[model samples]
Target: MRIYLAAPLFNDIERSFNERLTSLLEPMAHVFLPQRDGKLMRDLVDGGMPLEAARQLVFEADINAIRRCNYIVAVLDGRTIDEGVAFEIGYGRALNKVCLGLKTDDRTLLPSGDNPMIIAGCKKIFANTIELVAWLRGGFLSARDAG
Candidate 1:
């Protein structure tokens, strides 16, 4: 199974989260993490390429990885979901790939309710790592075992 992990890679905390989750999932499935696989921007920037060009390199790589993966695990736990993560979820949905939202944030964007669009986009929104893991183990992976 291949999983495309979508998250903001702008800071240390975000990068660490991506790395930890990637490590957890790597043994069970192929996880394409943007921070790790889409490091072309950092590399190009260190090589003196313009920041905009480096950004484009990352954008192209991540989108292609999303299209290729069997599923997408999007991190939605912050003051707001990262725009890139939201776009990845939408693109994955458009591609007919399963989208799993990992939102551990207690903050709510809308007090009344979550956006219907985000609600419907994800097959399920997991509130924690344990919940997410149980789901991965109990859902499609089990189906694969049976088949």
Candidate 2:
């Protein structure tokens, strides 16, 4: 099984979070992290390409990876969920892939008790990593055994 980790990677905290998340999930399945693994954008910018072009490259790469992945693990912890992460989760759900939303933040943003649309799309939502990883690994392994 392969997992697409969708999260904001703009700052050090977000980057570290994504890295740790990938490490935790790597043992159970192949992990495709848009921030860490999307080399095209970094390479393009490093090679002196325009920021807009680099963004496009990164977006396309992530969308393709999301399509190929069997599951999506999205970190929704923040004052508001990242736009890209939300879109990726929605796209993954539209493709019928399992999407797990990880919301570790203590604060809730929406007064409607989280966006019904976003919650509707996720197969499950987890506030902690341990339980989420265990469920993910168990489900994948059980499916493999069944097949």
Candidate 3:
């Protein structure tokens, strides 16, 4: 299986969490982690690439990766959902790819919880990484056994 991991990669905390999650899932599937696979916008601009060009490159690369993935695992942990992650989830849903959510954050934008549209986009929302890993492994084992 191919997984497109969509998460906020703006800071050390977010990037580190994404790397850790990728490591766990790597043994099970081919994980397309943007921070590793795609060029960072900041890096490109810092290296003398124009801001617009960097943005376009990053956008295209992510979109193409999403198209080729079997599933999209979006990290929905924060005060509010990341705009890029939200867009990726919506895109993945439009492409009929399986969309899973990992939200460890207790804070919510709404009184009830996360936004309805974001929740609706996910096929299943995991409260923690352990649950997500277990669920994926179960599915992987089942598939392997069946095959």
Model 1 misses residue 110 by how many Å? 1.9
lDDT of 2 by residue, 1-147 (tens): 899998888888888989998999998899998766775566799999999988888878888899899999989888788888889988998999999999998676877667777788888999899989999989988999999
lDDT of all predictions: 0.85, 0.87, 0.96
> What would the TM-score be for candidate 2 when compared with the true structure?
0.92
lDDT of 2 at 91: 93
- What are the per-residue Cα lDDT tens digits for candidate 3 across 26-105? 99999999999987999999999999999999999999999999889999998899999999999999999999999999
For model 2 the local lDDT of residue 133 reads 90
Residue 79 of model 3 has an lDDT of 85
Q: Which candidate model has the greater TM-score, 1 or 3?
A: 3
Which runs of model 2 end up more than 4 angstroms from their true locations? 40-43
Question: Candidate 1 — worst ten consecutive residues by lDDT sum?
Answer: 110-119
Number of the candidate with higher TM-score, 1 or 2: 2
In lDDT terms, which candidate is top? 3
lDDT of 1: 0.85
- Give the runs in model 3 whose Cα sits over 4 Å from its true position: none
